[model samples]
Target: MHWGYTSIGASTYKGFDVSYTDLIGTFGINFNLFNNDVVRYYSGFRLGLIWRETTPFPAVGGALGFDIKLSKFYSKIQFYLGMRLWTDYREDQKNHFYGDSSGYKRGLITNNALLQENGAIVLSMSW
Candidate 1:
């Protein structure tokens, strides 16, 4: 499981403040490609959900990385470095108004897009 927070803002959108809090949980199967007393390499596929705001988007991805043993007495302790790539669908809503004689008009605009080429660096411990 992974959890993170992100904040984004633009000077052009003075009155608009955009931020995101994300929580992600994944389950997958991994296989070891190389294994030794000091190091190991593995690869895996993952299926998960990314929760942003009130909606949860389905995500699919793969990971590849290696781990280095930190101590012989504590074999469960390992340093890990990995990379992941995933894709998901996201929808967002925006409010817009146009100039008119009837004052400001409000319209709900929904933006939908397929988000791809999303990558994250994984630096963590293995137990």
Candidate 2:
């Protein structure tokens, strides 16, 4: 059992304002819930701050989600998943077309290609 804090967020379409923020207080337990494996299951209560182009103020909301991890000696592959359901966050929000001066704008858009939205499936995989 442990108490911890973690945050994951994405920038607005303009790449200026913060489009979404997920700051969660997590209570997790590590056990062999599935097998004799090291798996940690997490449940979180969270505070969310969101910025939209049309709204006067950043939308405030609450989010609920679970995170699961499977690590260590899985033959060769290491797998981790971080998927959350949020409120007032835009997952399908499109950014404005910025001028490509030095390919900087193009690079920024492609970096971390995860949809910053509420309740949308954002998948992350790494080796």
Candidate 3:
């Protein structure tokens, strides 16, 4: 499940989030466990971008999380938790070029669309 809290003034915050998951099959799938009492641990890549407004800083960031599945019979539910390694907004003009770089013109200072740090968690139910 993804969630975020936006601070309106000082002690107030507006928050929201969303998440989804998919499960193809249980016993018919080769990835299924041979025993019924098994809880399967799975790992894959997670990638997504988020956009937030009215935030202290307008930012964007991608997320990465690990996934695990708990199963019984033919039904299973998966949960994910991970972190993002980059930011999502152009917060400031850090490495931005404002002018020419060939020593011909004055270079302008600006913030490039640099990445930021972000993360999220997710869960899914399937059979």
Each prediction's number of clashing residue pairs: 0, 2, 15
Model 3 misplaced stretches (Cα beyond 4 Å): 1-61, 76-86, 90-114
Model 3 whole-model lDDT (C-alpha atoms): 0.30
Question: What digit string (tens of lDDT, one per residue) describes model 3 on residues 1-127?
Answer: 1222111112222452312121111111112246532333332222332223322323333333333554334534433233322233333212322133233222133233344333445454432
Global lDDT of each candidate: 0.42, 0.40, 0.30
Off by over 4 Å in 1: 1-16, 34-74, 93-112
TM-score of each: 0.44, 0.37, 0.28
Task: Order the candidate numbers by lDDT, best to worst.
Answer: 1, 2, 3
What is the Å distance of residue 38 in model 2 from its true position?
Answer: 4.5
- The candidate, 1 or 3, that scores higher on lDDT is 1
Residues 1-127, model 1: lDDT tens digits:
1221121212122343443334344444444444444544544454545434455555554444444545567565566665555443333222212123243223233122333335666665655
Q: Considering every candidate listed, which one attains the maximal TM-score?
A: 1
Candidate 2: residue pairs that collide:
90-117, 91-117
lDDT of 1 at 54: 50
Single out the weakest 10-residue window by summed lDDT for candidate 1. Answer: 1-10
Comparing 2 with 3 on TM-score, the higher-scoring candidate is 2
